[model samples]
Every structure is written in C-alpha cells, then in structure tokens.
Target: MIGLVLAAGAGRRLRPYTDTLPKALVPVNGDLSVLDLTLKNFSEIGLTEVAVVVGYRKEAVYARKDELEATYGLKLTLIDNDKAEEWNNAYSLWCARDVLKRGVILANGDTVHPVSVEKTLLAARGDDRRIILALDTVKQLADEEMKVITADGQGVRQITKLMDPAGATGEYIGVTLIEPEAAEELADALKATFERDPDLYYEDGYQELVNRGFQIDVAPIGDVSWVEIDNHDDLAKGREIACLY
Candidate 1:
C-alpha cells in the first residue's frame, strides 16, 4: 500500500505562515514540519512509498522534496492540484485516485498524530477489504470535528461535521486505510462528491460509500493524543504533541 497525504488546502486562517508554504509545511517541532511527522509516521510503519497531493503554495514542498525523501527514507510521488485554492479536499483526494489503486493509507496534512494511530489502522487490516478509518472514540469533540456514527455491526452509518456531538460515536482523525478492493469505488465516490459540491470534505466520500451499502468500518484509537492544526491555537497545541512523538 502507498501512503497518501492531502496537503492542498490554503489554510487561510493561518495567514502569513501559509502565505508562502502550505499548511503541511508549517513547522511544529523546531525545523520539523507537519509533513515531516506524517512522513515519519508512514516510514516507521513500513508504508515507505508516499504520494503527496500538493497545491496552494506547493512550491515550498517541491523545494524540500529531496531533503524530505532523504530524511524519511521514502519514495515521494507528488500529485498536483490546480484547483486547490477553489475546491476542498474531496477533489484533492480524487486527484490521487490514479496514483494508488492497489491500496493506500491517507492522512490529512494538518493533523498531528503519533505512530500509534497508523499502527491502529494497520493492525485492523485483516482479510477485510472494506475501508477503515482511524477514529478517536475518546475525544470530546466540538462541531468542527468530522464525526461518525456506527451501526450494530460497527459499520460507519454516518460521517459528517453537520451531526450533533451528542449523536456521534467518535471523530474521524483524517486517517484512513483503503484496501485495493475498495479503491476504485472510493475514487468514484470522491469524484461524485466533488462534482456535487466543490466544498465537500473527503469524509463525504465515505458517506457516499456507506450510502451505497458498502461497509466502511471505524478503528477506534483509544486514548490517543493528536491535534488537527487549523489556526495559531491549534498550531501551539500541535507543537506540544509533536514533541511527545
């Protein structure tokens, strides 16, 4: 399986930091960037071949490509997104559909999590061919979190930010394991999601899969510490967590 990262968004709330660099390049630990931690996590877990979907000041990432590859000991596949500034991540992910059909572990560029989160998703990849999402079941989520609700069989019934926190089982940590068996369908779903609305999140693609009678399961990461860096406050919290990793 290949490791994929969605690092296309402009992250406008981040301002001057994102003015030249994408959100993924925002340094969290000294000189180590959010991309650094993500690549490190993927490399440590043996997904050494990675594809990064880049846009919104993507030149910053390209400038550091060789250094990043040498540091992580992974082959880099960079996917360009021309509409990154206009569209949401649903399109960014769909842009990578042609890159990895065998399988992929996709994570958001702005999220900072430990190797444990990747291990949690990898551990659950048994004979099951369904898509598996790493969910933080223990986190007290706010409205901004992409929440999921499970069915009786632990299948994800609903996944969206629109749901009430009280109705959610957990927050999807923006890490997903897509098996070869489901990659094509996922791509189609992602395409449809973006075609319907350019601003839709990739979780909407998961919702499309669920709506199609496909079972998208959730692997709950118990008591795992992670943060999604959106603004200055989130960046501060991410720095603290990055130090622990």
Candidate 2:
C-alpha cells in the first residue's frame, strides 16, 4: 500500500508560518517538519511510494518535493486540491481517490506522532478489516476531538465531533488505513459529504460510510505521545512531544 497525506488545509490560526507554507511544513522538531516526520514513518514502514494532497500555498511543497524525496528515499506523487481553501478535508481526501485505489496508510499532515502509531495500525490489518482508524482510547476526550462510538460485535457505529464527549469511546488520532476494497465506496461517500456541505470534515465522510453499513474498525494506540497542531498553542505542544518521538 502507498502512503497518503492530507496536507491541503490552510491553518489560518497559524499565521506567518502558514502564510507562505502549508500547515504540513510547520516545523515541530527543529528543522524537521511535520511532513518530514510523516514521510520518515512511511519510509520506515517500507512504503517507498507516497502521495500527498497539496493546496493552500502549494508552491512551498513543490519547492521541497525533491528534497523530501531524497531525504526519505521515496518518490512522491503530489495531488492537487484546488478547493482546499474553500472546502474542508472531505474534498481534499476525495481529490486523492485514484491513489486510494491502490490502498493507503493515510495520515493528516498536521499531526505529530511517533512511528509506533503507524506500526500499530499496520499490525492490526486483517482480512475483514477495510478501514482501521488509530483511536486514542487513553486520551481524555474533548469536544474538539473527533470522537467515536462502537457497537458490541460491530465496528464503529458513529464518528463525529458533534457527539457528546462523555459518550465517546475514543478520539480518532488522524491516522487511518484504507484498504483498496473500501476505497471506491469511501471516495463516493467523501464526494457526497463534501458536495452536500463544503464545510464538512473527512471524519464526516467516515460517518457517511458507517451510515451506509460499513464496518469501520478501530485500533488503540495505547498512551502514545502525539499532538495535532492547529494553532500556536498546539504547535508548542507538538514541539514538546515531537522530540520524544
């Protein structure tokens, strides 16, 4: 499976840094960017081919494409998301539909996590599992987190940020493994989600899949040190935890 990264969003909360570069290029650990860590993890997992969805200052990624490839020792396919500034990540992810056909270990570019999270997801891959999300069961859930609710024997029942935090089983850690078998349906779901409302997140697309009777499973990352950088505060937290990775 190839590695896919959704790096199209313009993190407006993070100025200056995101003014020229996308959120993915924001450095969490010294000169090593969030995208750098993601590529490194993908390379470590022996995924030599990777695809990245770029928009909102795409030129910055273009400038670093060759260098990133050389550093990771892997070739990259940059997918364009023209609507990134206007729409949410549901569209950004749908833009990579063709790449999804090959199956992918997907990561949000703004998340800073250790390679173990990816290793955990890879280890949990089963024949019956089509979509497996890295869920942080150990973390305290908040309204800001993309929370999940599961059924007894079934997989995920609901995944959304609108749900009450008290009722959620865990928070989705912005990492997922989408099997080739589920890609087409997921792409369609994403399309429907974004077309219905451009502000919808890709997590909403996952909700659409679950609504359509898809068994979306979850794997716990077990007390991992990770952070999703959204603003300056999150970036500070990311930098603190990234060093441990």
Candidate 3:
C-alpha cells in the first residue's frame, strides 16, 4: 500500500502562512512540516512510495518535491486536485482515486501525530476489514470535530460533524486505511458526495458507504498525542506536541 496525503484545501483561517503554502507545509517542528512528519512516519513503517494530492498553493509542494523525496527516501506521486480551492476534501480525495487501486494509508495533510498512529492502523489491518479509520475515543468531541458512532457488529454506523456530540463514540482523526477491495466503491461514493454538494467532506463519503450497506470499521488510537491544525491555536498546540512525537 502507498501512503496517501490529502493536502489540497485552502486554509483561509491560516492567512499569511497559507497564503503561499498549503496547510501541510506549515512547519510544526522547527523546519519539519506536517507533510514531513507524515512522510517520516510512512518511511519508518516501510511505505516507500507516497502519493500526495496537492492544490491551492500547490507550487510550494512542487518546489520541495525532490527534496522531500530524497529526505524520506521514497518516490513521490503528486496528484492534482483542480477543484481544491472551490470544493471540499471529498473532491480532493476523489482526485486520487486512481491510486486507490494499490490501496493506501491516508493521512489528512494538516494533522500532526506520532508514528504510533500509523503503526496502530497498520497493525490492525485484516482481510475482514476494508476501510479502517483511526478514531480517538479519549478526546472531547465538539460540534466541529468529525464524530463517529459504532455498533456491536455493524462497525461505523455514522461519521459526520453534524452528529450530536453526546451520542458519538469518538472523533475520526483523519487517518484511514483503505484496502484495495474498497477502492471502486469508495471512489463512487466520493463522486456522488462531491457531485451532490461541493462543500461536503470526505467523512460524508464514508457515511455514503455506510448508507450503501458497507461496513467501515474504526480502530481506537488510545490516548495518543495528536492535533489537527486548523487555525493559529491548533498550530500552536501542534508545535507544542510535535516535538514529543
């Protein structure tokens, strides 16, 4: 499986930092960027090939592509998301659907987490599961977080930011392991999701999969130190915990 990163969104809330750089390029640990950390984690886990979906200020990534490849010792496959500035990540993810044939361990470009998160997901992979998300049950869920609801054997029944926080089992930390078996259906679901509403997130696509009778399971990342950098506050917190990772 290849490492897939969705780094296309234009983080308007991040202003000047994102003005010329994609959110993934925002440095968390000294000179190491969020993308750097992800690549590092993927490398440690022996994924020598990585695909990054880039848009918005994609030139920044292009400029550093060679260097990133050399540093991580991995070949880079850069996928372009033409609608990145206008649409949400449902489209960004769909843009990389072609690469899904090989399967992927997907990481949100803006998330800062340790290699343990990746290791946990890799360890949990099995033939019975097609899509496995890294869920954080320990974190306090808010309306803005992508919350999840699971059943005894039904696996993930719901995944959306609109769900009531009280009923949620945990928050989806934007990391997912998509098996090759799930690729076509996931691509179709994402296509339907984005075609219906450009503003929909990829988590909505997961809901579409559930709606179609497909079970998407969740693996709890038990008390892990991680941050999804959105605004300045998240970036600050990301920097603080990134060094520990």
True-structure lDDT of candidate 1: 0.91
lDDT of 1 by residue, 1-245 (tens): 98999998898988889888899999999999889999999999987799999999999999999999999999998999999999999999999987658699999999999989899898898857479999998988889999999987758999999989999999999899988888799999999999999999889988998899889988888997899999999999999999999
Candidate 3 C-alpha lDDT tens digits along 11-36: 88888899889999988999999999
* lDDT minimum window of 10 residues, candidate 2: 146-155
Q: For every model in order, what is the number of clashing pairs?
A: 0, 0, 0
The CA-based lDDT of model 3 is what? 0.94
Of 1 and 3, the candidate ahead on TM-score is 3
Per-residue lDDT of 1-245 in model 2, one digit per residue for the tens?
Answer: 99999999899999989988899998888998899999999999999999999999999999999999999999999999999999999999999999999999999999999999999999999868999999998888888988999887788999998999999999999999999999999999999999999999999999999999889999999988998999999999999998987
What TM-score against the true fold does each predicted structure earn? 0.98, 0.99, 0.99
- For candidate 3, the per-residue lDDT at 210 reads 99
Clashes of 3: 0
Q: What Cα-based lDDT does every candidate model obtain?
A: 0.91, 0.94, 0.94
Candidate 3 wrongly placed segments (more than 4 Å): none
